[model samples]
Each structure stands twice: as structure tokens, then as C-alpha cells.
Target: MIGEELEVLYEVDSTNEFLKRNYRSFHDGAVVVAIKQTAGKGRFGRTWYSPEGGLWYSVLFKPKVHIGLHVYTKIFSVSIAEVLKKLKVKVTIKWPNDIYYEGKKLAGILAEAISENNRVVAIVVGVGINVNNNIPDELKDIGISLSQILKKKVKITYLLDEINKYAWHLLVTYRNEPENITKLWKKYLYPKEGAQIKFKHEGEVLEGTILKISDEAMYIDVGGKVHVVQSIHELVE
Candidate 1:
């Protein structure tokens, strides 16, 4: 069972960091959550703003060797999106792992691998959802909370449980039926096929139309030339 053991903290530097540092001490399904994170982390060395009222947590999982680390981020993110939609939040996913509502970010995820001898042994997946937390006016254009969208405060415990339940169900489905998970996740991804997009490549920005998205890369038609966008950071939007 996922998240069968849990740890709740008042504050922490980073929920993901806590799990990684103590990776050996906890069981495979253990989870760690914090009310506030002073030094939250984001993708590509960016900082994750995790103030009070958001759900900041990490899950420890030791999966099969063939599993790609990136898949955890995608899987968990879609689970979050599913839960929000049930609340009538109308959430959508940004490829590679982010939840957005009307172009503003609602959540982000970070999944790291614990490796030994060049082989991944475990993964720590951290998730952050902007719930009832106050967003500064300057950052309001890029961030939003559940309360802001629903016009009411969402109970933190209830939301957390919903997310965990959906995630675990999807995980089990993935293990038993691996073929359809990707399509299910892609159903909510934004910038759908044929959308015009821009990105930085080799220090120069290029424009393109999204052709297709595979697990490892997004095939884009740039000036009639297909350029594979393998990293989410390559996207300019």
C-alpha cells in the first residue's frame, strides 16, 4: 500500500530533502508532509514556494528496475489533477509535471532517484498544491490557490486523502496494466497537439508546432524540421 506510514511536520526545509536524507530509515511506502517549507525545491534547481496552507509532501517508493524516474512525476501529477477535477476545479496538466488552472500554476512535482551502481533503487516523489495559502499580488498572475478558484476553503486533510487515494489506485493500475497509463495522463496535458509553441535551443529561441509527445520526448515541427524536445526546461512558455 502507498503511504501506509506517515510523518507530519510543522515545518521543514524541504519535504523531498527530508525523505532523501532519511531514505534508509523509512519503509518503502512511507510519506512525509509539512505545514510549511522554508527552503522548498523546484525543478532545475529552482525554489518551490511552500508557505502555510498548501499540501507539501513526499512519498518513498522502491519500484522495479525498468521504471523510469520521470514516470513517477507524471503519474502523481495526473492523480492530483484528477482529484481537483472532482472538486470541479477544471485542472489541466503541463507536460512533464505541473497542474494549471486557466494558465496559472496550481501544483508542482519533483521526483528524484536514489541510485546504486548506476541503477535506480528507489524514488522520492514530492508534491506541492497551492491550497488556501495567500499569494502575493506580484505573483498572483502565475500562482493560484483552491480557495481563490472555488470561493471557499478546502479542508487540507480531505484534499490530501483524495490525492493519495487516487495516486495509489493509478499506481496499482499501472503495475497491472502498463499500456494505457500514458494516454490517461495525456488526456489532461495542455498545449495539445498542433499548438504553436516556442522554446530556447542552443541559446536561440525557436518557434514550432507540437506534433506529438512520447514518454521520452516531444516531437515538434520547427520550420518543417522536427526537433525533439526532451527537457521540459526547453519550453519557453
Candidate 2:
């Protein structure tokens, strides 16, 4: 029941922002999709290059039980990767929430939460996929489209149906067996042990080696000290 209402728009500034502004009116399990986004957003205020042929959408979920923000992000990443596998595409998830294929970015997930009186209310999950779009020259080295990978156009409707199916399944699992979701996420993680990486945190750049990953943070070994990073802006490897 994750996508009970699908709202289709020809254009929008940002699907996540749109849902946040009007979430009070929409019921739970509502979805907002845009054909083109002029100002699509990414993690840490980055702009997502969403053109006409890509899939840009957001889903509103009202969980019965309280779920941490990091856990919610992992749910969507795992669901998206599951759908892509059904379409005969192999994908790996970068830490915290990015979908990568063959070392290039294929999709991104952004989760925003709404709270009232110190209690959680609703969560908006935004997803962007390079379905049939053309990657720009500047992004060609880092971005890729499904059509480009498959050498043919992929039907948007079919992709949406598959995504909705996996989304609902994951949501139910999260409400019932949350630990299993975390196991699935770890199974799809891209990096190996002791890999060197760099990330931006709190307006400062730090380099570290991966030590371990918990539910909501990554433990890294930096300068002979273990640093726990709850969120990262960029992954420089």
C-alpha cells in the first residue's frame, strides 16, 4: 500500500519539497511524480540533474511504529536495488544512500521527515532514476541511464510498477522485521573492508578508512582514532 495515490505532474521544482509543502493534505501512501524537475535536490544541498526522460518522484509514508531516519533511507535503497535486479540490471549501493552501477551513479534516494511536538509524523522519500534520459557531457563520466546500459528504451510505467511492488514489501518488512532490512542493505553495499575514502562532514573534509558500519553511522579509522560519521556529503575515493 505504499503507492495508493500517484500524482503525476508535468514539471516540478523538487518532488521532496513539493510533498513537504503539501503533506498535510495528502493521505499516507501518496506518491508524487514529475516528468521533469527544474530544481531537483540531492543529499547535502546538491542539485540532481533530472531531465525529461528520467524518473523523479517522492512517496509519503506514515509508519505505524517509529523508525529511525537512517533505517528509512536504507529501506528505499534496498527496494530500488531489488527492482533494478528484476529488470536485469545489477546495482550496488554506496554507503548512506546512492545507487551505483558499474562504478557510476544510476540513482539517488533522499528521505525527509516531518515532526510535531517532538514526535515523528510522516516521512517523504524522494527517488530519482536515469531511465531514458541522456547524460550530459559533464556528467557522462559519472552518470548513466538505463536505456544507455540496455541499449534500448525502458518503459517508465513498467519501472514504476516494479518499484511500487518492492516498496510496499520493504515497508511491511520494516514494520515487522527491521533487522532483516539492514542485512539486505549490507549485502548490497559496494565497498570492502579497509577501503580508503574521503567525505565532507560539518563543513570540513576528512579522509578515513572504513572500519565498520552500524545501522545509522559508519565507523572509520582516521589518524589513529575511530570517528563515527552519521552523515556524509560526498564520497571521494
Give TM per candidate. Answer: 0.93, 0.89
Q: Write the per-residue lDDT of candidate 2 for residues 151-235, one digit (tens) a residue.
A: 9999998887788778788877666677888889889987744778777766787899989877667788989988787764455
Which stretch of 10 consecutive residues in model 2 shows the poorest summed lDDT? 228-237
Off by over 4 Å in 2: 193-209, 222-224, 229-234
lDDT top scorer: 1
Q: After superposition, how far is residue 193 of candidate 2 from its true place, in Å?
A: 4.2
Each prediction's RMSD to truth: 1.8, 2.6
Q: How much does candidate 2 score in TM-score?
A: 0.89
lDDT of each: 0.86, 0.86
Cα deviation of 156, candidate 2, in Å = 1.0
What clash count goes with each model?
0, 0
